[model samples]
Structures are given as C-alpha cells and as structure tokens.
Target chain A: MTFPESNLRRKKLGQALMFGLARAISYGIVAILLLILFFIVKQGIGVVNWRFLTAMPENGMTQGGIFPAIVGTLYLVAGSMLFAFPVGVMAGIYVNEYAKEGPVKRFVKMMTNNLAGVPSIIFGLFGMALFVNELNFGASILAGSLTLGLLALPIVIRTTEEALKSVDDTFRQASYALGGSKLYTVRKVVLPIALPNILTGLILAVGRVSGETAPILFTVAAYFLPKLPGSVFDQCMALPYHLYVISTSGTQIEASRPMAYGTAFVLVVIVLIVNILATLLRNYFGKKVKMN
Target chain B: MRLRRFTEPVFESLIKISGYSTGFIVLLIVIFLFKEGISFFNLSPVDEGSSLWVHNSNPVKKLTAPQIKDIFDQKITNWKALGGNDQPISLCTLDELGEAFTEEQLGAKFERLPACIDSYIDSLPGTIGFFPDKQTANALKNAQPVQVDKVSFSKFISGTEWFPTSRPAASMGVMPLLLGTLLVSFFAILFALPLGLAAAVYLAEIADERVRRILKPVIELLAGIPSVVYGFFGLVVIVPLVQSTFNLPVGETALAGSIVLAIMALPTIITVSEDALRTTPRAMKEASLALGASQWQTIRKVVVPYAASGITAAAILGIGRAIGETMAALMVTGNSAIMPRSLLQPVRTIPATIAAELGEAPFGGLHFKALFALGCILFIITLIINFLVERVSAKRVR
Candidate 1:
C-alpha cells in the first residue's frame, strides 16, 4: 500500500512539473514580445514628436520627420487595395459559391498557397522583370502597387472564402425562395453578411502592404526623393524601406540612429493598431454571426 | 429584362476570369523567372567584350572561370599544375600592360597596345593576358585565346566563391549563399521547435479560457510586426548582446539571424500546433483518463500523436518562412558572401544576396541574370516546402 501511494504521488508530481514548465514557456514567449515593444517605444519616444510626423527629412535623413514616407505608404496601400480587393473577393466568391469541387478549384487554391509562399524578393524580381522592364512602368508607384497587390491577393482570397463559408446557407435559400437570381442572392444575402469579415481581411492586407519592404525595394521604393511624388508614375519614399535605409545603408548610420528608432516605432504602431482593429472587428462580427 | 440577360453572362464570365487569374499569375511568375534566369547559363563567365589570352606554347588551351580566378589570385601559380610545361604562371592585365610600355612606345591612341600585349605574352611562356576581345582579336600573333567554357550548371552550384564583380570573370558560385541560407534556417528551426511546441501545448491544453483568449491575439500581433522591425531589433539589441557575450569583433553573425528568425517563426508554429492539439477528440482523452492515465500522460501519449501531422506542418511552414525571410537576414547576417564555418560567423543568404546586389547589377547584364537565377532557386525551395505541407495536412484530413 505504501509503494502504490508513492507511485501515485510521483505521477502527480510529474504532471504538475510538466504543466508548470509549459506555462512558463508560454509566458516567456509573451514576455519577449512585450520586451520588444517596450524597448522600441522607450528608445523611439524621444524622436516621435509633431515635427517628426509632419516634416520632410533633413540633413541627409539624420533629422526631421517621415511624413513623405508615411504618405507614400498610404498611397501604395490604397493603390494595391484598389487592384487586389475586387479580384481577390470575386475569386473567393467564384471558388466558394460557383466552382464545383474539382481539379480547377483545387488548382487555384494550390496556386494561391504557392503565391503566398513565394518569397517577397521573388515578387520584386518578377515585378522588375515584367512591370518595371517589360511593361515599361519604370520604378514607379504603379509597379510597386501591382507587385504589392499580387502579394496581398492570396490573403484577401483566403479570408473572403472563410467569411463566405461562415454565412448560413439558409440565408441564400431564403433569397432564392423570393425569386432572386444567383447573382442577386449572393449580392443581397451572402455579401451583406460577409462584408465585415471581408473588410477585416482587407484591413490586415493593408497592414501587410504598408509594412512590406522587399517587394517595393526594386519596384518603387526610392532611396530619397527631395520632393513628394507628383503622380502615380513617379518614384516615392516608403516607410519600411526608409527605416531599412537609415538603419542599415545611410551615410549617417550612427547619427540617424534616433530617426531609425522613431521610424520603427511609428511602423510598429501602425501595424499593431491595424492588427488590433482586425481582431476587434473579427470578434464583434464573429459574435454577431453566432447570435444570428 | 434583355439588358439583365446580357449582363448576367458577362458578370459570370468576369467572376470566372478572376478565379483563373490567381493560377495565371503564378504561372507568369515562373515564366518571368525562367525568362531572365535561363539566359545566365548561355553567357560567358568573363566580362562582356573581354577575353583571356595565353602564350601559344602553353599546353593549357582551355580554362574554366574558377581556374582562371585561382591562377590570377595566385592560388594556382605553377603552369605544371594546370597541365602546362613546368613554369611559373604570370598574370597580365590592361594596367599591367600599360606599366610595361610607355605612351610614346605604344602610340597616341594606344594602337600598339594589342601588339604590346601579344609580345608581353610571348616574353613569358606562362603569361596569361586579359584584354578586350576587340583589342586581342586580330592583334595577337604569338598568343592564343584560352577557350573559356560558358557558365556551366555544375560549376555554378559547386563553386564556393561568390565574387560577381571579379575582373576578367565574375565568380557566380552560389554554394556559399545556399549554405548560409540553410545554416541560418536550420539553427532557427532548432531554436524555435521546442519553445514553440511547449507554448503550443500550454495554449491548447493547460491554459484557461481567459488566458487563451488574450494570448492567441497577442501571438498573432507578434506575427503582424514587420520583419524590418525585427531586423532593427536584432541589430540594436541582439547583435550587441552576442558581440559582448562572445567577445567577438562583430555582433551581426549567423547566430543573430537565427535568433531573430526563431522569434519570427514562433507564432506560426504555436498557432498551427495549438489548433492541431485542440482537434484531439475529447472522447479519446476521456478514454485515456478512464484507463487510469494522468492528464499529462493522456496529452503526451494521445493528443500529441494525434496532432503529429499538424505539428510537422507547422515546423515545415516555419522553416519555409525562415528560408525565404529577406530583410531581417540581410540586416543582421552581416552580408558577407563567404562559406560560413560556425554560428559566430557572418553569412549571406540567397534572398539577402538578391536584395543587396540587384540594385547595383546592371539591367540585362550577367549579374542581373545571376540574381534572377537566385530568385528561381528560392522559388523552387518554397515550392517544395509548400508541397510538403500540403501532403502533411492532407493526410490529417484523410
């Protein structure tokens, strides 16, 4: 009886030890994240003032603000969304609602996955080859937007498919019962329900596009442009690429360290805010879908 | 009604066309990569409009790019070593030829430069001269052009050096960059797997509902942080820490890259593996408990085994991301294009190489094509990884 009790106690102790180890690991991962955020914010907060947000860089980018990069990023994001949104959503609709479960659907899904997996640098090369060279777009906003739009396509498509899948089939059936055509039913019933979730995906894509540096490296990002881009055909400065330049390749790497930190802080803030917004939107609509 | 009838088919076709565009775009990427990359093999390793000339009596009539580089760099100094008569190898370039003759001796337009080059080669049995092909074409009387093989596939793959800007010939050996990429990714996965697995288990099984709710989104946010920021963090924090702790000259080593990549890969591994663990049937766990097993034992023996495919997928996806990761590796890996010997050494990855060099490589030039070829290699690597993930996850579904 004593031996059996000891054995049981040993098992219980082992269980507690393993559980505690796992919990510690989980917390440790979270701690690392918090540390990164804290370190950046602490180091960068001094440089992220009003002038930093609104003025053009000065003194070889060792001083002043990142306003043009911010505006350029906004332009790239909007332009990419303009291209990727409709195509990705329509592709998702066709795949989920119309295309039969067959090789064609499977092939498209595989392609999307492969596209997502294709490193951003490859996209840069392809963009350089096709858009920049073959299409004669030069290293302008047009080429960068197209490249980034392609990068975001798979994300948008996957999210739209998931959102559309979540809408109840009875909603579609009800629309059909009222003599609505397939397109009408989808427009009236399916899209209205899936719009918020789809928007969540679009917002996340925007975050991704704004943060991406590699795709824009050759396609559009300029080292420095004295004046803002006057049109879509012109090259422009971007936030992520600017951060990379000032931190790694600038003439005043040490002198501009403060600016690097400040840029990183703003970029992180933008991405994190977008992520939080996406999460909130997802949760709110997720609850609504369940309640309905 | 007629207008609606006409528009319906048009709308349907538009949707169908959009659906097809994804695959079409992927196809276009492959086409474009090959279109630029395949031509690299057809070009000579030597600079355009330049050729290497050797004495007529020298037995080594042909040389590969690496052999020529080695001979010029004095790594191979004996003619006998290169299948020639016993003699010391001598290298002559345009500047060296200029040193041999004055402007008055060569002529005002340097029209006598080619004759001067030929006679210089004639003076030394082991001499190899590098000059423009146009200059040496009909001018060399006693010297013969060494037949340089075009860039071969085997040489490109196995050659260890990566000097794309070397004179006379650009050394486009991809081995060092390939090894560096694999080395960093291997170490990253090594660091990430255990931590990611443990965190995944906690999120899937041990964590309370409230903790899971907060932790999950936080992890997603971790993934959302731009890779460039990670690179910056690695440069500022990890690089210095590595340098001081190890007492090294530089902190931007493969070790720094691995650490950053590991951190970046963790979220993907945790999220995927947690989802897999959650899918372990509740009934299966109950059955194990009914059989007098502890919760930990049930998890270890039953839940983990059930989710093994998913965990494998997670690991592969993480590795794929690590391999393809560019900006961070570029920023922190020190960007040295040498064969990496240890984690402490700075290394250059394929993506980083392309990112750094593509700007300087002239359009439609050999260097540009070589970078495109690197892109092709990256494309294939990720392609294989994606295929493997599909296989693993598909097995779970079945």
Candidate 2:
C-alpha cells in the first residue's frame, strides 16, 4: 500500500499521541510513587537513629524501635532464602538442563506461574491453619519464616529459570564434549553464569517479604509484644505490623505518628542498600570472570 | 555401567521428584484454600442432638455455654426478658461494611429461626443472632450498647460501638467497621481506577521506548512496595491532606483509603494496558493514518480498540487489587464499622474484615468460620475474574 503525503504526517502525529499517553501516565504514576517513597523516607529515617534502632521504643514515641523487627526480618529473610533458594535453583537447573518439553515440565511451569499470583493473604491463612496452629508452632518466627519462604519460592524459580534460559547453549555443548556430565556442566558453568540474575531475583523477593504485613499478621506479629523474642517459637514484632498498629490502632502516642514513616524510610533504605550491595557483588564477580 | 545404573536412575528420579513437587505445592495452596473455605457450606442442625455436627464451645467466657446457645438460638426475642420491658431482639448480621440488619428489617429466608417460634416471649431474655466472638464481630448477646427506645432492632444494629467480646449487655458491634472497609475501598477505587486507567491509556497509546522503560520500572516498583509503608504515608500525609481539604472532623475518612488504594493499583493497570497497546500491530496504526486520521484520532479509535480487551483486563486487575487489598485499607479507613453511603464516609471491605479480626478468632469458632467463609467468597470472585483476565490477555497477541 502506498502512503499519501498527508497520511505520513497524520500517522506520525497519531503515534506521538499514542506514545504520549503512555509517557504521561507513566510519568504521573512515577511521580506519585516517588512522592510516597519520599514522604516515608523523609518522615521515617530520622526516627531510625542508631540508638532508636539499637534500643526499644520508649516514651510511647518509639513504638519499640524496630531493632527486634530488623533482626526478625533478617532472620526471616535468611531462613526463607535457606529454605527456598536451594530448591528453587535446583528446580530451575532441572527444568533447563534435563526436562524436555514434556507434560511434567509443562506442569511445573504452570505451577510456578500460579504460585506467583496467589495473593499473600491466602498464604497467611494457610500458614495460620497449617504451620502455626496445626504444626503447633503457635505464632513463632519459624512459622513466619516458612510462610515467607513459600511466598518467595515462586519468585526464585521464575527468575532462576529466566536466567538459565538466557545462558548460551555453546557452553553446555563444550562441557559435554569435554566428557563432563550434565550435572558437572550445570554446576560449573550454567549456574555461575546465571548466579547474578538469580541473586537479583532472590534479593527482590526478600525485599518484598521484608515489607509485607499481611501474611505474618495471622501467622505471626503480635501487638503489645511486652518482651523481645528470645527464641524462634515466640511471636515477635515486625516493622510492617508495627507500622500498621501505629497508624491504625495506636491508642497511645498519636503525636509520634512519624515513627511509622521512620520505619518505612529504613525499610526502603534497607531494600535500596541490599540492591546496591547485590549489584556491586554481581559487578565485581562479573569483572573477575571476564578477566579470567 | 555402574554409573549409568545408579546415577541415571537416581538423578532422573530426583528431577522428576522436584518438578512434581513444585506442581504439588501450587496445588496445595489452592486445595488448602478451597478445603477450608468450602467447609463452611456443611451446615448442621443448630437445633442440637444432631450427630452430623460436632458440638463447638462458646468462646465468650463472659457468657455461659447455655447463654451462648440461648443467644444464638434467639430463644429470648425481646429486651423485656433481660429486665427491659421493650424492644424486640432480631437476628442480625454485619455486612462487610459492618452494616447490620435484624430479620424483621431484612425480611426473609433460611432455616427456621429459633426465638421467632417463642413469639417474642417477654419472660425470655432478648438475644441477637449471628456469630460474635472475634474482636471484629458484633456483640449480639450481653451487648449493653446504648439502649435505644426504638421499637425495632434495626436502630440498635446501626449504633457505633462493636465489641464482640465484652461483659454482659455492654457490647460493641462492627457497624462502623463494615462501613469503614466499604468507604475506604469505595474511595480507593474511585481515586485509583480512573487515574490508573488514564495513565495506562496514556502510556500504552503514546510513550517512547526510553521513557517507557524508565516509567515502567518506576510503576512496577510501586507494585513491589510493601503496603505497610503505604499505610505510613496515608497516616502521615494523606490523612492530613483530607482533613485540611474537607475541614472534616476526622482525617481518617474513606477518602484516605481511596488515595492509598488508588496509588497501589496504578501499576497493575498501567503495566497490563501498556503491554496491550504496545502489542497492537504497526499495520493498524499505518492503515488508520492512511485515512488522514489525526494521531490522536487514530489512537482514540484504532489503537485503543486493539487494546480494549487488555484495557478491560487491566481494569479487572485494578479492581482485584482494590478489593483484595487489606492492610492499607484497614490502616487508613478508620476501622469504624458504621453504615456509610457517601465516598467521604468511613467504610470497610471484606478483606479488611478478615485481616482486622482473624488473628483473635479461635479455630472452629463461629466467628472464625465466618471469616473463613468470607475468604472463600473473596477467593472465588477474584479467582473467576483472574481466570477471565488471564484467558483474554493470553489471546492478546502482544
């Protein structure tokens, strides 16, 4: 089809308009989201003073500084990574290296996608019924860890799978030609290449769990937590839940509402810091491998 | 040969195991939700002596087992039996917005109510129906709420306080709570959907690749944000903005909830619809322009039509986000279970109902079961919409 002279100008204008809609909407959304983050960080970071974090929330303003929550969130993140990463990464390896386009492999892919979409509150309910109450752990850190672990499993799998998908086939071919087994090639070559991407995914997942309040609301996170968690079985406070209480149900310290912002600011900083650290590690290792 | 015999079988079997296990775990979540959620349908004889149902305990220690039974059974149908000579006791239920109604007001069907047969027996105590044990549920029994002299039970159901667990006759029901959830979600959807759609429509129809990349990630990060932080922003900023703007008595009105939910759902709508528009074929835009259509005209017509199904999916997804969101809604919505019709009024939604109260609810208790039942309802609705969205979006060639 031949285009008329008028058509070209009109089409270009139409394209710009179309593109502008996306541009404007995206910019607006970004601006608001940034505002949200900026607000939280501005209000919250001041309260996350080193002493406040190290010590408990005092004089009602503190909301019991998120020291225990930081530790609890860390513990939960570590525990979840420990629980899910190996299984998720291994599953990715199996899916990429071994499983052909068979029904079993297909089913695994479907499961991974569905797992990603299940709203986390459902996870909370399931955890409450099965892990916390049924497993008789009560509202302990262990239950929270396991539930959060399950939440992250889908992320780990999907990201690791994508990373593996991007790996070149020549590496596998060379490894096999050298009489290396599939396992040896994957362990040595495929995994190392995909490590950065996989780690990035894991970090993102941890960031998500660290900030979530719903799953642990019923599974863990007690309000009015008098003493700190001495063990894994005891219920502990979390920054997210603490923020919820301070904002929603706080009968005390209505004036110290900024503490919630302080908590959020710290949360965002922690996420950004982890992301930066992960990026550095990835970059450092990436450079090292290239040099080698 | 030895390696083949052991390694081949062992390694292959292990791969098979993990692949199958992941599928099983996903299935396990669905199965778990359906199983617990479905258990609510197995209604048994509340009339007692029926072996089909197990005898559950009355969780409220303030009332004895018999009292709990009498109250739920509504054997005492009027206030006169409880030392007041007036007012009829009605079977009441708090809707998600904590809107309550007695049988007389609701007017309608079910298994025969117990106290109704006794004919408003004056000797019998006034009893309220519906499960009330969890902190969010209303105190129908021994709920000594402000005694209104109204002849009907609907007036009492509309009152403010909603303590499900309280001393005799002094009680609080979640009328304000139900209202709070609805008001918040309503306001949230009001703010979120239009703004989200406008942005999504814009991004999908017009943005350059470089701008799209930066903007898309920023929006996605909005999705990645933990909601507790949103709650903080709402409490600190949005609350003040609303109070100052409206000059209303309370800052934590439905308007705050709308603002928060609107922000949260923005990314989903934009991402989905933008992807939809992006995938619209270059050929279509070319054809539209050949007709001398303005770029704006071409977009308003051809490009948008191409992405219509995707836009619908985005809207549904936004709606899902709005409906299912709990923490932000709960935190900002003032948690008052009152009946509110206006967007400015405080209201609560079903998800908030479960989140705000499920913690204190004992397993197998009436309140617990009711919340679980609500979960089931939410799951079914969301799952159906999700399924439809997935189906249509998948067919979208982009």
Candidate 3:
C-alpha cells in the first residue's frame, strides 16, 4: 500500500510537468498574439485623427481620412452578403431538405468542400480578369464586390447546410405528420427552428468577407479616391489597401502609422460585435439541439 | 420519351447542375492561370525571335519613352540631348516643371551606380528604366519617357507592370519576386505552427469553459481581421521592435513580416487543431486513468498521436494562407528585391512585388505575364498543400 502511494506520488509529479508544458504552450501562444496587437495600438494610436483619416493619399500615401475605404468596405461586405445569402441558402435547403442520398448531392457537397480549400489568390486573379478586365469595369467597387460574393458563396452554403442539418429530424417528421406540405413544412416549421443557426452562419460569413484582402486586391485597385462612391464604377478606398500603401511609402510615414492601427481597431470592433452576436445565437440554438 | 417522363429521370441533369456554379469559377481560375502563365514557363525558342538565345524584341536594340527617361536622368546620352538638369522635367534640365533643375544633359557618369537604373538613367538624355509604383510618383518629375519602336511613350496608359516584352525577344527575370514571396510565407509558417498547435491543445484539453468562450473568438477574430490591418500593425509595431532589438538601421525585414503573418495565421491552426483534439474519445483518457497512467501521459502518447495527421493538415493549410497572402506581406516587408539573408533582413515577396508593380506594367508585356506566372506558382503550392490536407484528413476520418 505504501509502495503504491509513493508510486502514485511520483506519477503525479510527472503528469504535472507534462500538463505544465502543455499549458505553457497555450498561454505563450495567446500572450504573443495579444502582445503583437497591443504593440500595434501602442505605436500607432497617437497619430489617428479625424483629419488624417479624411485626407486623400498624397506623395504616394494615404494623406486624407479613410472615409472612402470605410465606405468601400461597407459596400463590399453588404454587396457580397446580399448576393451570397439567398443563393447559398437555397442550395443548402435543396441539398438537406429535398435531395436524398444521391450523386447530385454528393457532387454539390464535394464542390463546396473544394471551394474552401482553394486559395483566395486564385479568386483575386479571376476577379481581376473576369470582372475588371473582361467586364471592362476597370478596378471598380462593383467588380470587387461581385468577386468577393463568389468567393464567399461556398462558405455560406456549407455553414448554412450544417446549421440546417443540425435541426432534429423528428421536427420535420412531426410537421409532415400533421398534414403539412413538404414546402410549407420547410418554410414554416423547419426554418423557424433553424433560424438562429442560419443567422449565426450568415453573420460569421459576412465578417469574413469584410476583412478579406486578396480577392479585393486585384478587383479594386484604387490607391485612394478623393470622392465618395456615387457609383460602383468609381474607384474606392479600403482600410486593408491603405495599410498596404502606408507601409510602401505613401506620406508622413509616421502619421500613417496610427491610421493603420485605427483601422485595425475598427475592424476588430466589427468582428467582435459579430462574434458576440453569433455566439449568443449559437448558444441559444445549441441548447435547443441538445434538448431534442 | 414517354418512358423517361414516367420514370422522373433518375439521373436528372438539372438537379446535378444546381449550385455547381461555385465549381465553375474555381475551374476557370485554374485554367485561365495555366493558359496565361504557360508561355512564361515555356522559355522555348521559336523561329520568330521568341526565345532565350535570340532577343524577342531586340531588348538592346533601342529604348522606349520610359527607358529614355531613366538613361537620360543618369546623363548617359549627354551629347544626344544637351542642357537638361538631373531632374528630367526641371527647367534648367528640360524646364518642364520649374527652375530648380536644368535640362542640359551633358557629362553624366555611368560608373559606380547605386543600382542598374541610376546609371542607366544617366546613359541617355532621353533613356529610361523602370521603377516600381512606389518609386514612380517621384520618378515622373525627375524622368521623362520616350517612344521606341512600336511602343509609344503613351504606353504607360495602356499598360500595367508585367514587362515580358523584350526587344528582339528575351526571357524576363521575375524569379526574385517569386522567390521573395515564397521565402516570407515559408518563414511565417515556421513561426506560427508551434504556437498555434500549443493553443489548440490547450483549448481542447486543458481550458475551462469560461476561458474557452473568451479565447476562441479572439483567435477566430484574427482570422476575420483584414491582412492589411496586420500589415499596418506590423509596420508600426513589429518593424520598430525588430529594428531596436537587433540594432538594425531599419526594422522592416522578412522576420517582421513573418511575425505579423504568423499572428494572422494563428486562428486557422488553432481552430483546426482544437477540433482534432476534441474528437479524441473521452473513453481513452478514462482507460488511461484506470490503467494508472497519468492524464498528461495519456494525452501525449494517445491523444496527440491520434490527432497528428490532422495537426499536420492544419499546418499545411496555414502555410498555404501564409504563402498566398498579399497585402500584409506587401505592406510590412521592405519590398526590397533581394534574396533573403536572415529573417531579420529586408526582402520583397512575390505577391508584394506583383501588387507593388503590376499596376504600372505595360499591358500585355513580359512583366504582366511574369506576375501571372507568379500567381501560377502560388496556386500550385496551395493546390498541392490542399490535396495533401484532404488525403490526410480523409484518412484520419476513416
């Protein structure tokens, strides 16, 4: 009995060491990442001002405020979401609700998976050639938005499908048993139950497109537009592109530093808001999924 | 037809086509890249002066408006065009802008030049060489372009920076940009993988629900944040920190870029790895406990081993993101076109080079296709990584 207890003590010590190492690794990762973000804010926050953001790019940099970029990003996120939401959802509904086990379903699923794996740069090239070059849009906001729409469509479809599939199958059967048409059951019974999850997925995808840079790079080539976007044809500014310019030697390199951070802060806020909202929704639905 | 109608066409083609539109774009990008970039890799000699041995367009035979501007600025052709200031548009030199610099282009030196362009620009009063977009704005005032052969000085308007066109037909050297891009991305993966893996393990196995809820989205937020923001963050924070730490004259190095990129890639690895660890059945841990094995020992020996393949796939995808990333790398990197020395040394990357220069490349020229070829290279890398990930993940699933 004494032998076993001592052995247990020694074993316990070793386990503690291993757990310490694993915990160290985890803490180290988070600390490093946050340190980096804090460093950005520390070095650049002082320079952010309304005037700096409102100015135009002068002497090869963003001289004015990034109002245009803010608007451009808004348009990009809104436009892509508007386009991706309906089509992706419809496809997901068809796959889960209508299509049974079949080749068509399999092929669609495979394509969706493949889309997630494909690099974002290819999307940039395609957007550049097809939207800007072929379509003669010439690096405008609309072209960028459309390209982003196409890029995010796959994510929207997959996430929405997953959300829809998570709903209890019994709920669907009950709807059908209660003399409900398949279409009506899907539209009313299944959708109401799955709404929170679908919304969470939508918010998550929207957050993604808002922050994406590669696809937008080739599609929207304007360095800094002085005027507000009255049309999609007019070029626009974006925070991501602004960061690119400032680092490359636009103007008052010191001054531009804060603008970059300010934009980062803004982006973080947007994402944080989305995350909080989505997490609440997911939690609400997750409880329901568990209960059933 | 009647029988087909009655059966409801089990292989219904319309149903098959539904939502396959996503596949359509992916296919088009891959095929289009191949088509445009194939010639860059071909490097074969044809009968019409289109190979390495012969000049495709007589690169040395003559100069264009831009070449004129570059060579002339350096005063290479002092006698050909006289009395031009060092600044191309200066009144004393050419008097186009103001009275500051003269237009008399005489007695320019070609020896001991800063780079190829500095002296080349001096060679001819009207000669020019290319500078990237970063240098272009100031370059315009100091250098003026001239028409050469079929290409006009107005060529800048019709063109973008892919200059594959060489007089007498010659091969273009875009390798530096491509190499630079690959190098930064490669280093980024190296720095990010371990940290991200650690986070994943911690989150999946060690953390409480409160910590999980707080930390998960923070990692995920890194994914949602724009790369440009990372780039900006790099410029202001990492660059200065590196500079001071290493006592380097400037801080914008590949290492700085890697740090920012590593941070950018953390969420991807952490998320994937967490999922991998979460899938480890609780029964295994309980069994290890019953057998008197320690919790950590069980996790290391059994849990991690089971998740190894998944972790590797996650790492590859993270690397793919690193390699293909454009704006952040373009921003934080010094954009200097040199083979990287240490992580601390400044270097240009392929994606950054393209983003920096492609806008100004003369359209349909050699430089343009070279950027496309660079894209092709990036695509292949991601493609291989993706395929490997699929194989590994599928096997693990099985």
| Best candidate, DockQ | 1
Error of 2 at B99 (Å): 35
Superposition error at B217 for model 3 (Å): 2.9
At residue A144, candidate 1 shows an lDDT of 98
List candidate 1 segments past 4 Å from native.
A1-3, A289-292
Worst 10 residues of 3 chain A by lDDT: A55-64
Estimate every model's Cα lDDT from 0 to 1: 0.93, 0.66, 0.67
Best by TM-score: 1
User: What overall lDDT, based on C-alpha atoms, would model 1 receive against the true structure?
Assistant: 0.93
Q: Say which docking band candidate 2 falls in.
A: acceptable
- Assess every candidate by TM-score: 0.98, 0.75, 0.76
For A42-72, candidate 1 gives per-residue lDDT tens digits of: 9999889999999999999999899999989
> Candidate 3 lDDT, tens digit per residue, A1-292?
2457788888789878766776787777767767766766565566567765566545445344666777788888888888788777766776777777989777677667767766666677777877888789988888888888887888788877887787888888998899776666777888778878888889988887877777777688467665778887877777666556555564466666556666676666677688788888898878876776
lDDT score at residue B382, model 2, on the 0-100 scale: 63
| Candidate 2 chain A: 10-residue stretch with minimal lDDT | A57-66
Q: What is the lDDT of residue A68 in candidate 2?
A: 67
lDDT of 3 by residue, B124-180 (tens): 433333332332232333234322433322232233332343333223344555566
lDDT of 1 at A279: 80
List candidate 2 segments past 4 Å from native: A1-25, A60-64, A224-228, A274-292, B1-12, B41-190, B197-210, B283-291, B337-340
Q: Name the fnat for model 3.
A: 0.53
Native contact fraction per model: 0.77, 0.48, 0.53
